[model samples]
Target: MFQGRLVQGYDFVDGDTDPSEVGAPYVNPAYGHGTHVSGIIALVAPEARIMPIRVLDENGEGDFWRIAEAIVWAANHGADVVNISFGYPQQTQLLRDLLDACSDGTTTTGKTFPEIGINRLFFSIAAGNSGDSTFIYPAADADDSNGSLAIGASTRFDRLAQFSTFHNRVKLVAPGENIVSAIPGDRYAFWSGTSMAAPIVSAVAALVKARYPNLNPVEIAERVEQTSVRISYGNPQIRINRVDALCAVTLIPPATCNP
Candidate 1:
């Protein structure tokens, strides 16, 4: 069933291109966060292609400038969706500029539309693990007007995770606590964090994109948001919603399913 359905993927984290290297002690001793993320995307959108671009190191540290460049690379290489499982505590102008450019259908280096006819690319970013409403780069910058989705972590009980950062910028929440996914060495493990949550949104975006190829990033993001299950988790000041894939795929116009 998995044959001929393999999707091309990219990894921006550190270590060798070989996903198995994630199991090596010197490579990704942290246990393959990128690989795990890719696995989730594949599971959610089994027919979509994935491209791995290594940007962050084994310690999950990377330069903002490099990340900006990676976004351009993904766009130029025909990537329909980009999933960012990492976040910075503070915002940076450079990152903001790159993301804004992407939303406007341009590259950071001033390049215009690609040959693929795609204007804007979708991005799903993790809120942060700081457990506060403090702003995190990229995620905090994610605006619905710009076709980006900022994701926070929510528990299976429909409550926000204590470690998840909250803010008005957060667009959606997903099941992230103790979530099980693929690790290196053909293994599966339970992981938790906004990192885990962001990919869920990314995968959902992929599904929406695959089903509705005509929808732009903004429309796709809207479908994901509108079809979500609303949850009033503790913070009255913020509205948190969990993704509902079935509703997104089956619901029609002017009709929504919110549980």
Candidate 2:
């Protein structure tokens, strides 16, 4: 999948393209996207079982219904945490209902919370790379107590990534720029986007889940946020969280965590 039309080589510099515009075959901008996200999860929580679900095509383009269906499938199949790196610009009732139902412990979504041995499945989502305050869906659907976390992207310099989407929905940020992870054909590449950030947070979330299986998903998400390192971006008053895996899983909050 790393082999894209009109694209050659595999490295930090050789990645990224517009598959639709180029009419590329088998290789799109999002070619090998799944592997990159999954690789980060495996890196952080080496023992966690990674379920690679296909809801979008090679270009990261997908319909909301398909995404909604994927969520239900993952939750029912004993997935403790679901990582959603893609989002739409608009909100839809179908997604809201499905996520709400999951949090409410209803079996309406073809899965019941009790069946999975957890109160609710957690979702670590990307806030989009729009680089503005515009609202993004699914992530925007985060206001509810559904264990849904809206994450933004930050750079190595400890500042918000210029391309990361941020607003009231986003509660945390993580290193997303120049991130190196696995791709198809057993290769690696450096990709940048909120897509890269969510998995890091989700990986940590999985660790928290394994350490405290009985904790509610919301509680788990909160712990991650509460123990995060606070970062101020363009606006001094506007601060965002940077997840601290050690703080989230440990009994005591680390010095890096905000009081």
Once fitted onto the true fold, the runs of candidate 2 whose alpha carbons sit more than 4 angstroms away are: 1-26, 106-119, 254-256
Best by TM-score: 1
Give a tens-digit lDDT track for model 2, residues 105-160: 65345643343333367888899999999888888887426777899999998889
Among these predictions, the greatest lDDT belongs to: 1
Tens-digit lDDT track for model 1 on 100-191? 56666654456443432344688899989989888888899897677888999999899899999888898799888998878766788788
Error of 1 at 91 (Å): 1.8
TM-scores of all models?
0.85, 0.83
Q: Model 2 lDDT vs. the true structure?
A: 0.76
Task: Return the lDDT, model 1, position 172.
Answer: 90
Q: How high is the CA lDDT of each candidate model?
A: 0.77, 0.76
